[model samples]
Target: MTSSAFTESSLTGIPVKRGKVRDVYDFGDRLLFVATDRISAFDWILAPGIPDKGRVLTQISRFWFERFTTISNHLLSMDPADLPLPADTDLEALRGRCMVVRKTEVVPFECVVRGYLSGSGWKDYQATGAVCGIDLPAGLKQSDQLPEPLFTPATKAESGHDENVSFEVMSQAIGQELADSLREKSVQIYQQGSEYARERGIILADTKFEFGLLDGTPILIDEVLTPDSSRFWPAETYQPGGAQPSLDKQFVRDWLETTDWDKNSTPPVLPDQIVEKTREKYFEAYKMLTGEECTW
Candidate 1:
């Protein structure tokens, strides 16, 4: 299949917000979320996007949202035909890449759950034998599985890196009742996803979730369990002492690290080889988890 990329999207209605990869349109009681093919790394949206990435991410989230019936979510439908699209809208372009969902006041924290020692959690553990103020056992190596998944929250920053914050801090900022609820739900969702992925020969190391409130009820919002929001490693080659091969954006990050360009500047356009490989990784993760090929 030929690859197609959408760096940005323009709809008839004014966009309420534009994230690194999604363009959200307000529809009074609901929202229209369009997942573009735009890719981001080091907190910067790169020049070129991986092809069919939006469809892969959208479909994967749809698969999880349908299965997570134990909790409430913002998803209404993935079919563009169900959305209140503007007249003359390109339905074909939006198919499988857009969602119609209930609107809510989004929480200000990034609800993260870590099942393994890697990424920032690994760095924090190496520095203080703890992650997000929660102490762990001594001598845990990189990518080592934690005794159990930990709910480590972070402040949701609009720009720059998200700083890890303790549960106490989170409770103070969002109230003890709400903080406790978010933590419990985040961990539960992560556990469910990890088990499902493990059975499919993939390791869902960790994932971050975003939540919002609708009439004082917490609901899962944004993308869920997509490669862009989680670290997925192949179970066949799982090794704990070092960085494991991944089925996520680690490929792009590894290539970026080899360049002389500092992360602060505008990211360079990805070469064709890198873009294709990244697309394949995203598609592979979706296929492995969903047991179906991407329609796009």
Candidate 2:
């Protein structure tokens, strides 16, 4: 891992908004998105960013955004030089890690699609035989493939964890028509992505997507189907009876579980070995899905 990692970005002539991993710079007409190498587990941003993680994430998202043209998205271009950045900005530093995207009125919900019973969905099923008020078959094991992919939406929170809500609640908040459209589009995107991943010996267990309206037209926004937003399990090693082996942030999550730190409060700094292993897993996932090595 390199000693240099981009945790935040500052550019002239743009207003900035920092998230858990991405840095957004508003340019009045468009937005500049920079995927930093910062990794967050349990909603806490950890120290010592993962090397080349930003480039890997940017390329992976670009791959999916271009491939899934059946749905509209906010991506304009990945090249920083092509964008209207200020003359003083560092183009080389932003290359491969930045995106110039169309700005839109972002919807205030997290459009989630689950192809398998895992994570919170599994817990919800075990407790009430339903996930987000959608009933599931009895006796479904962890990591088991569901009968069909489900559209489970949750409220987008600025801090802490996002709370899962019923579709009816989502509809009431965002209007039934827009909510329905988001659900349909989310399921379609997940199905297409999952089918492609299965052929590559990876399982797209579940993923969350964000949407925005451009002149009243809903287009996919934010990071789509990255390791931070989805679970990627190895198909050959998949066993529904237990937690499946993954090529995503599950590596980091599993390691964090072993630490003595409580889920609340400040997170402990990760060891060097854990950081290297996590970086390897992220790169492996990009290569496995796209069949292309990350040059950075």
Candidate 3:
């Protein structure tokens, strides 16, 4: 692993749009997704990102995208050498961190599926006994497993947090037919992933998926089933009464809660130990999920 974190990429002759943790370069017919080592929590970008984080996320997504053969997605290539680039582009540095995907008109919603209550789902349940308008059984704990997975959609925000919305609201905005189709696809993928993770001694408690339209056909887009987009908890240590230990960046969010810094402004940099431990967590998750060493 490199001692430095790569939070940005330089590509001379192309337009790039940066999100919380990725640098997206428009490649005309296709888009280049460069997962940077940037980390964000509670809508605030944190400093001193976990090293190899982009690689971990990209590889994990690649593993899932390749594993689910029936699902159509935007991923075209993971090798940076496959794409034409500017003269100053860093191929070696971009190796595992980059992906070339077919560009499509993205659906403006975060398709979330949850088999277990947690995060904003838990908060909403505590307040209204439902999540995205799906009522749950009474007396459910923070991390309690639900009766079945629910497709809870959210508004896709460019910045800040994505707001949870009822399926009816999403259907009204995007039309009933498309909304239902995306919900089915989202829940189906979640079930497939959750079952697989369980067999591997991990619990995919919940996850968010983004889809896009290609020739009027819905296809999965953006990152799929990565630590940044999913809550992966070790099965052996899971207890549903409260927040569980996770293999993703949730620990960093946990650590941030201990600080006096208000989450409104810029957050504090993670300590060296925190950074090291977080890196280990990402590495461990990748190793367990793929059963292969993350050479990147």
Candidate 4:
């Protein structure tokens, strides 16, 4: 469907926090997560977001949260009809993109699990034969599958890149026991999720997870295996030598690279073609992973 982007939302009297692509509204013990069409690249939220982007991301996360019941997630419900929304609130706009979740003390670290050498992991391996201080085999190509998945922890920054840190550093910051537990849980979830994707002809190259404590136990929080949080490569076209075809925002990034918009300044507005193509990628990912057409 042709439509304008829902870059942000307003609900009277409710405090909201805008992240890179999601708007979080605090409702005392509950938090409303609205994944908007906003897209970010090189640390800037670009203009004129691709419509339906938010729905794809939110529904993808919902699929994962529902599919993997073994892993505890913070999702209370995807429907917010029962919420005390303001009289002027746009429930139709929020449809298929809102997540109502329980509030928790979010963990400070990002639990990243890498099953393939790519992205920042590939760079680290090229430099040190390691990722997050965990050593890997030598002579591995850019997108080569690792002998085993590695749990690399990163410090979650408010803005900019999340700094990848060693597991020892993570342990020191959040105690050895908790860090170890989080790592194990992250690896386990990645293994399960990746296997499921592989069966559907998609490779879950790597994914990052965010966790929060509830009753002294860490439970999955934030987006799970959505394209925004994971690197998904088409298995049939996978090549270890370099970057493989992806079903994510790589289209947007590739287009941005061709432009001269200095990242120091405001990012350029995406062209109509670029916006539509990027939206298609998000929809394809949601469909391939969920086994259902994105009728929304």
Candidate 5:
């Protein structure tokens, strides 16, 4: 099946706010968030959506939510299965991924925790000798493991890119105690997630997580460990020298890089083959990491 094969229908009576990928509908004190098959890379939404991409993301999120809820608070209900759903709640259509979570006021910051040197962290370190605010050991190369994981937080931008803020800047913004707590929690969550993925033959090379305040306490909200919000590299092809072939959307990213399309401009529509390959990649990642069949 192709992206053209799955167009989203508006939820009955429920208003929605669509993001780059997910469509979020208000549900009183909670929210019903649905991940679509749309795929985005390099901050651009590419053409030819990945079939089952949304279901894969949702299943992964649900897995992590079940695994780590005891470690910290998350936006979950006791009976997630009974939440209000669409008329076509057929397991295949709704999948096992769609989430009906308690909505909280989203924090204005993105709590990024890194166990390795790569991505934006590498770029920032190469230029400024630091990542976010934490200074790093000299002579660190791309994909080099950090001595210890670090918490690098960034301010969530409204329109453009999110600016990486230092720990000091973060402290001043949200108070020292809360800042410290957020950083600690972020590192702990990353540690658990990274270990879990590693055992499943995937290197979760640093991912970002979001937290929100519910009744004055922080709870993990939004998607966690999805390809859209992460850098997933297959363990078999993993190499430390250069850019790794990722199970995420590197296929799309690579194609975009070979084109004349500027990153700042509108991205070109993806070819059918590229979209199909990307969809298979997402499905494979979900299966390998979770050890579960992509039923949807």
Candidate 6:
């Protein structure tokens, strides 16, 4: 995503925070969250971005925010017409990818729930036969479904990848009551998300969620079920014997894997076609899951 599409000068709200893809401006008791098209991988922001990536992610989050409202409290106030946007703001230009949400103090932990063996969980399992201190059955391979959904909490690292910790560690960091609530809520959200995606012919292998508290109540915050935050596998191509074809950034990761460049070193610039195809995949996931056109 080009920086030209979003300028700090154009945003007029109380400054709250900024992250890799979003610039959040506080609006009194609410927030204006802007999604940018910037792409990050291996914990590094690349030189180029896939156009419309932000919109796709935003649209996906909007869809889930609507779909999941019955399950939990989420930070979404999607009514553009009623929002207190700047007078000259291009509301239409930001369509499909922005939200005006309630400003809530974020919970200390990032609630991550994994249903399959992959990524860092897989790496940790391969090393210790356990994930977040939960032991798994022997001889399990990559992409294997767990006996039950696992609650893997991780420290919200400032930069680079977040580090996974056991449930005990989570309770130690946060209070026992909040920790218990986070784990239960995380699993419930994942189960609902996975089941919903399954009906759409996609496998929700895993996903990460962030939660914030409004008073004593927990509310979901940040992005939800976007390609940037979840792993999607096409149901038809999913096989337990091999690496499943993913619908997220697997294409980008695979391209990087074949290169000689170390992930820590300068990341090789993504090619034009790869960027285009990746962008399409993000849109495809949003479309198939929501059954709605990505209009931004």
- Per candidate, the number of residue pairs that clash is 0, 0, 0, 0, 0, 0
Q: Candidate 6 lDDT, tens digit per residue, 1-296?
A: 33233322245544657677777777788777778777778887765677788778777888788788655555556655456777777776676567778878787677888899988879889999988788999999999988999988878866678877778988987789988988888898899999999999999888889998888778888899878899999988888856788789877888888889788788988887788788788878988899887665
Candidate 3: where are CA atoms >4 Å away?
A: none
Clashing pairs in 2: none
Considering summed lDDT, which 10 consecutive residues are worst modelled in model 4?
Answer: 245-254
Query: How many residue pairs in model 1 have overlapping backbones?
Result: 0
lDDT of 4 by residue, 60-173 (tens): 888889888886889999987767898989899999999999899988999999999998889988999888788887899999999999998899987898999999999999
**Candidate 6: clashing pairs of residues:** none
Give the Cα lDDT of each candidate.
0.90, 0.89, 0.90, 0.89, 0.77, 0.79
| Candidate 3 lDDT tens digits, 174-207 | 8999999999999999999898888988999999
- The reply for model 6, stretches above 4 Å from the true place, is 1-16, 79-83
Error of 3 at 43 (Å): 0.7
Q: What is the C-alpha RMSD of each candidate to the true structure, in Å?
A: 1.2, 1.2, 1.0, 1.2, 2.5, 2.5
| Model 4: residues with Cα > 4 Å off, grouped in runs | none
**Candidate 2 off by > 4 Å:** none
Question: What is the alpha-carbon lDDT of model 1 when measured against the actual structure?
Answer: 0.90
Q: Please, what is the TM-score per model? A: 0.97, 0.97, 0.98, 0.97, 0.90, 0.91
What C-alpha lDDT, on a 0 to 100 scale, does residue 221 get in candidate 3?
A: 89
Residue 41 local lDDT, model 1: 91
Q: Give the TM-score of candidate 3.
A: 0.98
Which segments of candidate 5 are over 4 A away from where they belong?
2-9, 73-92
Which scores greater on lDDT, model 2 or model 6? 2
lDDT of 3: 0.90
Show pairs that collide, candidate 1.
Answer: none
